[model samples]
Target chain A: MDIDTLSEKIVAGDRRALSRAITLIESSRADHRDQAAQLMERLKGAGRQAIRIGLSGTPGVGKSTFIESFGKMLTGQGLRVAVLAVDPSSARSGGSILGDKTRMEELSRDPNAFIRPSPSQSHLGGVARRTREAVAVCEAAGFDVVLIETVGVGQSETVVAEMSDLFILLIAPAGGDELQGVKRGIMEIADIILINKADGDLKPAATRTCSDYSGALRLLRKRPQDPQGFPKAMMVSALERDGLQKSWEEMTALTEWRKENGHFASRREAQARYWFEQEVRQGLLAKLDTPSAREAMQSFAAKVAEGGITPTVAAQELLQGLRD
Target chain B: MDIDTLSEKIVAGDRRALSRAITLIESSRADHRDQAAQLMERLKGAGRQAIRIGLSGTPGVGKSTFIESFGKMLTGQGLRVAVLAVDPSSARSGGSILGDKTRMEELSRDPNAFIRPSPSQSHLGGVARRTREAVAVCEAAGFDVVLIETVGVGQSETVVAEMSDLFILLIAPAGGDELQGVKRGIMEIADIILINKADGDLKPAATRTCSDYSGALRLLRKRPQDPQGFPKAMMVSALERDGLQKSWEEMTALTEWRKENGHFASRREAQARYWFEQEVRQGLLAKLDTPSAREAMQSFAAKVAEGGITPTVAAQELLQGLRD
Candidate 1:
């Protein structure tokens, strides 16, 4: 189908059309890239918006469980929910974190819910870019909520934060040293931290972990975008279906506050500009991937490794060659 | 002076010529850059090497005090020491972390020691590049040890780590939550963690912090370059000059083991290649700084922000323009 028909179908909340559009966005072929760009441009006229929540957690942090419960809750409340993931490791492992649709059986079967696994090709930057684009596609498809999930490791969290409206970090309850496992950079970007597994035997531990993180968050520099008592830690039990409603309420409250304070629109604008610069940087780096450029870089790298030429001098010569 | 004379003077331990060579390296002038490259090429034949130690800590962590005591100890042991700093904030504040020479009064007065402040202008990349070159000049000048210091925040630690053989992170003793302040990325790169200010009533707290960090480090994946009990934390009292000798011994022990295991030579080769790639990346980014390129980027960015064009499409157009 042409871009117009596909975009129209997507805006009408057709799941099959939305899936096809996302696949086009993930494809690296030249023709598909052109079509994807055209489709996105067409969809821009939809002017539909969703509450985009970025969620991240380490492996075994019960991310799938929480998403299943929370997504089901939204669908039951007459809201269409879409789930997308950005898995950096999928490029190497050929297995995505959300690859198993059975992991969220109930939500996957829900008519009002849409679930898509991560793309299992390309570098982290490309993966993130495609995921961000997929999010826009979901929003244009009349989804009331878009949940973008990523593993809590390396630079992935930062990339997810750039595309998200409110970033939530999920962590398993540990002993008194729970804060040690949290990265300082990740903590700085998180708008809310959820202590998962707050049911059964882990109840006391989760409460303690929640309080510890609350104190730690208090020590962080306050962001201008947040209202009072924001970016706080909360306890949640996805298994028991507890705290999901309260957490959703808090998310909507924060989103509404930001919308009233004018931070919501400005944040999206800044994120667009950030992604634009990132694309430019990636495009420039892609130039070095040609056979001749690779040969030149390898030869210069050998010289640098042997200490025969200073790194700066070798780089200058290589860049000069590119210019010529 | 000519490049030949400058290299010879630097090799022969002429401090003034060494200083002049570093100034040339730091200069942005075309002529000075050419001279600096030539001088570096000439000095490569000197074949002298020094232990390059990168130290980082937050401000008020007694970095100056620790360095003063450590430098005094090294100089007193008859080893010539050179101190260089990389301060990213200097570009904006016009003040450097190591700007005050009197901060290390005793070390500055020592005949066996050399102290230099951070370059007060340029971005972090340029500052790191010049500092790396200055390290080479110091090595040619027969310094037995070179200490590189940077603030313990942001990406500066990673930059300094790229140019140094050993990375040490210093922290002040805090009550039980010390690890919360440390960035996980920095912790992974650190070869050693030092708990400073272990004197007076804080001695007990320092020991507790050291133990806590030791447990945390043990949980991290073991690196192949390290031997048993490696990347461990230690307690030091820079105020009372306590643990200085023991820490020095540990550093030498680690260095000697790495040299024997062949990690020393390989690490430097890898660092040289890393720096070469960094320079190439920086050179590519510099193309975007031109007037016409700036205008193009702003126009594209504005379109992206206003939803007139997708970021990917705008970036592709901008890159195509560059190619044309």
Candidate 2:
């Protein structure tokens, strides 16, 4: 369909149209970008009145199970929810392949819930940009909540934390050392720490782990008004849906608190500012291979590589050439 | 000293002079940057003369102890060594006040060894930039080897990986679950995996963890070749200096292999290209806050926050106002 038709459908709150429009934006074709930008401009006023939550955990911490249970709980409360599971993309292919559909199979079938697994590009910052853009599409489609799942390692956790109003970190029952390692980074940013797989013999261990994290977090100064009202460590059995309701309630309360305060509005504004900077950076980099610059850089690069000159000097020379 | 004087001293292999020059480069003062860049240009001809190695691990995983033992091993072989430790900066003060001098008490006294712990900036990329710049200074000072000590968690590992030729990921004796958590993202990039504290009762556990990681790594493609050689996994008792010699020998072997194959030269060239892109991106972003742009953007931002306009349209409007 044409850009005008898609833009109209997206503004009218059509989910399929919104999804199609996002796919167009994700396209790398030069012409597609202009079309996508225009469509986005037309649908600019279709703002998401939805709450966005970010969830992070190391691989195999049952992030899928927790989300499935939590998504079900939200649906039970009659809230229309959307899930954006971000899969790490291959550096070579630059495509995510959207592998999360199989993990959230149950949630995907819910009519009130929309599940979209987008490929996380090579960099966390790139994935975050796409995810944020997709969330806007999801919001315009009238979803009440958008839950973003990040591949919880390296900078992805920070990227997710920056974009979401509420951030939850999932952990399992590994003792003190595991607790120590977690304390080093992502755990500090967590508004809520959910100790998953707290069933059978692991229940007691999960309780102990929760207490350890709670104590560890106390040493970390209170994160002045987290999206959530307070830092909480809760044990949840996703298989049995035990404590799922409590987790949902906490998430809801965090959303409510962020909205009532000025954080929700401020964070969105900050995210937009971040996106603007990223886009400019990306745009200029993409244009580095433009004919005139490429011709000037190539000859200078060859000389530097041959040991006739150093890279730093070569760069300065190239900048002078570009300026001239 | 003036830029030309500092550059001459560093190129003349004055270690103390080189250290002071690096401090000037890492300084945030605007004038210091101009001097540092000029110094870097002068020293470009003295590039890639040292083997750059990265060591990462959890705090208690004996990173400092391993480095001490390892540094002694290299110095014993008549090699002058320099260690650049990236210390976590205070989030509030943005200054690094870590007592690394106290941490490496013995090594600090070694005339053949130089240990400097630079405070990590708010951005991991910034730390990498300064460390790369420092490496150039150290190499020009006639240090045969450079070791970069990075904190294990978050983006620190990735940043360290990019800047070093050989990356050693230090893991402790946590079983399957912990291994499962780290098998992706940053850990997957390791060229060498060392299970530290492999002594006493922990020996068997350390051996098992090494084997487990080796098995998991088999699922990934072979570790990237260092200009020196391919990476490996080993068990080491940093306290006892057990396996320290083997690790050192392997590191040396890899460095030789890289030089002979010409991979070392090509890789450094690529790294220079990467750093150039990062500098341009950051430079452009700093310009985004020019007085007129900031004022116009702020007023447009207020409208976006009040829901009178969307961020995309508001940004365009602000840019237009600034241009006008």
Candidate 3:
């Protein structure tokens, strides 16, 4: 595959090319990583600023239903929508993974919408890395809206937050109050909270959940650049497609506000630096993952377990051996 | 200043020498670190498996009061108690830093109890590292119980959990239901839970909280080696010291069960390797923190921000530069 040709095709809004590019980036082959980098460089600034949205909730939170309706709503507005799900589960989620595709049958069939479930890889980091590169590829493919969906597990939630302009947390009505769903980790990161399944008898519960979440958000500190201050939350019934339009509007408005306030740019810049440092650590460790270093580390670990050497000292020795 | 002499003194239960050894270990100077490592080597296998109890809760959960009363009770039973606090606050904690001395007035006066407030430090890792070493010193000084208390913010709780034989989570009655505190991180690590302030008018609420926690713990899977098969919870009033004896008894029983089942040795061995890997990462990052590398990394970060380089590639390049 010629890197320049692939970049050009992706830039020209070819869905097949975008899919191929994502596949290339996700490849573990060294040559592929090199070509992927080249393709990224070539496609730099080729697309408009995308409305990057991060969606997350626990299993059974009606995430698929919400995304199907939400994606269809956006596509109806004549906007190109790209959905990338970062699936981290190796068990029990097989059903949900397939269920999502069947549930979103209409949206998946839409010409203006592109929906891709995560590949069956057990590594969460691999999924996150691919999802990030895929987000960029979708942008280059001229998708105006990129919705990255991840389960509300710790690792994926963190990855989604780092790569998103807006994070929307979806919750079911009876998950023991909105406060129960809201923990310190995701609570601090979420910009918009949506209490899903808010129709019929559950409407009152949803309203109370929204109010509870709103009250909780008030007590926490907000990002310095957010002019609207506290995170805004409301209830929605994705089954009825009610409140989907308002949620979309709120997301876009919040995004515009963040962009205007320079947070969007600053956050992106900071994320770039953050990933750079992380990769440096990972890249260095990759050297130690070699057979010789592994043996040395094992021996050093044995010595550490025997109590003759401290971990700090053993690590220093291993690093020295690596350096030498 | 000889490390051999210092180690001998600490092993002999010399409080002044133990305090001095801890101060030496906390020092950032290279020579002190070397000496501290030597001291640890000398004190290896000196203490007979001290009971390391990690205690944590949110700020207003009566941590100090609980520790004070609990330490007093243990000392009253002739068990030497050493309290090592990891204080995050810069404010009124200054008074508690002393207030602990005055507030635990009886315990402070007890020859069998040693209470030390945290040394003023901005870096959480530094504090954690020092606290870990301090626990060792306390153990060598013939303290059978080392209670490491940290506030419920993320990092400290994790550090305390890693170094502890058993983790005890202290919570007030009204801090939401039991499900509220049972998030992924520290919650999963805790072996025991105490609903503090469980006396008089608040007794019912504490009992409810305990039952709620017990129900929640049952819903979660336990470690295969946990003979009890679930984390136990109970109500206690620090003022009345009602459950202190039972809490200590539970901790000893759990520790003994884990030791017999091989979880204790395995966990310690695992922690040694965990810290070994972490130290390697930290030691390598320390190399980058140098002036020359910092300047080079800054230029690379600039290029990353300009989108000319991907963070993965930039990090790879940085690691290569360090190697070269």
Candidate 4:
């Protein structure tokens, strides 16, 4: 089938077409990239309805459990939902087994839900590019909400945050030890922080953890990219299935407020601009990978490694070759 | 003066020429950049003697206090010391006042010590460039120990780490609240973790924090760039002038071990490669800012911001213009 036909099928809410479109975006072949770009251009006129939410936390932070409960609650509201994981480890390990839908049996069984494992073959940058496009496909396929699940470690968190309207940073009770280890920029980018497992014997610890985060959040300088009401802390229990309802409501409310303030559209535009800059860099790099340029870079790299020459001088030489 | 004369003066251990050489590196003018590069080329075989160390922590971590005491001890051993800072906050705020020598009165007065505040004029990347050159200058000028002091916050920490032979992450005692908020990638990069302010009542808490960090360090995958026998934790009383000996001993031992195993040379080569890649990107951005290309980029940016086109498409258009 032609890409236009594929675009039409995806816009008409065809899950099979949506999945295929995502696969096209994930392909590294030159022809496939052109086709994917053309298909996106074709779908450009289509409106997006999904509330794109980025959900993240350190591994073993009950991410799968939270998504299971959260997806179920959203689907119960007569909403179609899609869950997409961004797993860099899967790429490294060549196995997308970690957050695959079999673990979320309840959500997997729901007719209104769709879950796709992360692409396990590419580097982090490529995975991010594919995940962002998959998000667009899900939004076009009539899903009311798309939850991008990414581990809160390293570069993955930043990538997921950029693709979402509201970012939810999830944690657990008595996690002060782990919290001390939270990456520097994660809290600043977080829209809402939820203390999970806030039930039974963990209740007091959860409340204390919430208070601690709240205090810490207060001290943070509000980052310009964060939704204004962000850095706020709340409590929830994925197992008890409590607080999931309020969490959904809050997520939607924040989205609505951002749209009303024009931040939603502007945020998307800014993201587009950022990716555009990145593309420019990548293109320049590709141009510099010609045989001669490669040899120059390699020679300079060795000289620099051996301390025979400075990197600045080598850069000057390779940059000259790019001009030639 | 000619670049060769300037290089000759710097190599002859002239402090005036050393400071001016640093200023030359920090210059943004294209001609000065060329001159500085040429001067570095001229000094390639002069050899380096200084043990370069990167020291970083949050603002309240008593960095200046620690450095002052540490500098005194080194100077007491008849070693000439040079302190160079990478202060992004100072850059943004238009003041290098924060880490200037006045904050370390004893070090400022030490006849054998040389201190230069961070260049208040450039972004972190530019500052880092100047700083790496400044380290070279200080080394040529016969400083036995060159300390690169940067705030423990943001990208500056990572940049400072790459340019040095060893990186020390410093913090105060009972800093769980602060630890929970450490910038990601930092703990993994640190060669040594020191809990300063270990004198008086803070001693026990310092020991506990040290143990906590040690346990955490044990869980981290040791980075290949780290010096062998590192990621070690220690306690220091910079104020009481105690524990300084052990800390210095460990740092020198790690440097010696790394040099013996050739990791030191390999790490510097990797850093050179990393910076070479960065310079390519910067050079490409500069090209994009040329008059015709700038106009195209602006038009595309406006279109992207107004939602007239997706950023990827806009990027494609602008990049096409660059190639043309």
Model 3 Cα shift for residue A304 (angstroms) = 3.5
TM-score for all models, in order of appearance: 0.95, 0.68, 0.88, 0.87
Check candidate 4 and list the clashing pairs. A179-B180, A180-B179, A180-B180
Supply candidate 1's per-residue lDDT for A323: 82
lDDT for each residue of candidate 1 in B210-282, tens digit (9 for 90 to 100) = 9999988998899978989999899998999999899998899999999999998999999999999999999
Q: Summarize candidate 2's per-residue lDDT along A3-88 as a digit string, tens digits.
A: 87887787676778877977886666768756766766666676557888888887788888888888878887888888885555
> What value does the lDDT take at residue A304 in candidate 3?
83
DockQ of 1: 0.75
- Candidate 3: give the clashing pairs: none
Against the true structure, whose DockQ is highest?
1
lDDT top scorer? 1
For TM-score, the strongest prediction is 1
For candidate 4 chain A, the 10 contiguous residues with the lowest summed lDDT are A175-184
**In model 3, which runs have C-alpha deviations exceeding 4 angstroms?**
A90-103, A119-123, A175-178, A199-219, A222-230, A306-309, B88-105, B119-122, B173-184, B199-215, B225-230, B306-309
- Candidate 2 residue pairs in clash (backbone atoms < 3 Å): A96-A119, B227-B258, B228-B254, B228-B255, B228-B258, B229-B254
Model 3: TM-score, first chain: 0.91
TM-score of chain A in every predicted structure: 0.97, 0.87, 0.91, 0.92
Candidate 1 residues lying further than 4 Å off, grouped into runs, are none
TM-score values for chain B across all models: 0.96, 0.89, 0.90, 0.92
Total clashing residue pairs per candidate? 0, 6, 0, 3
**Distance from true position, residue B123, model 4, in Å?**
2.6
Better model by TM-score: candidate 2 vs candidate 3:
3
Model 3 - which docking category?
Answer: medium
CA lDDT of each candidate? 0.90, 0.72, 0.79, 0.82
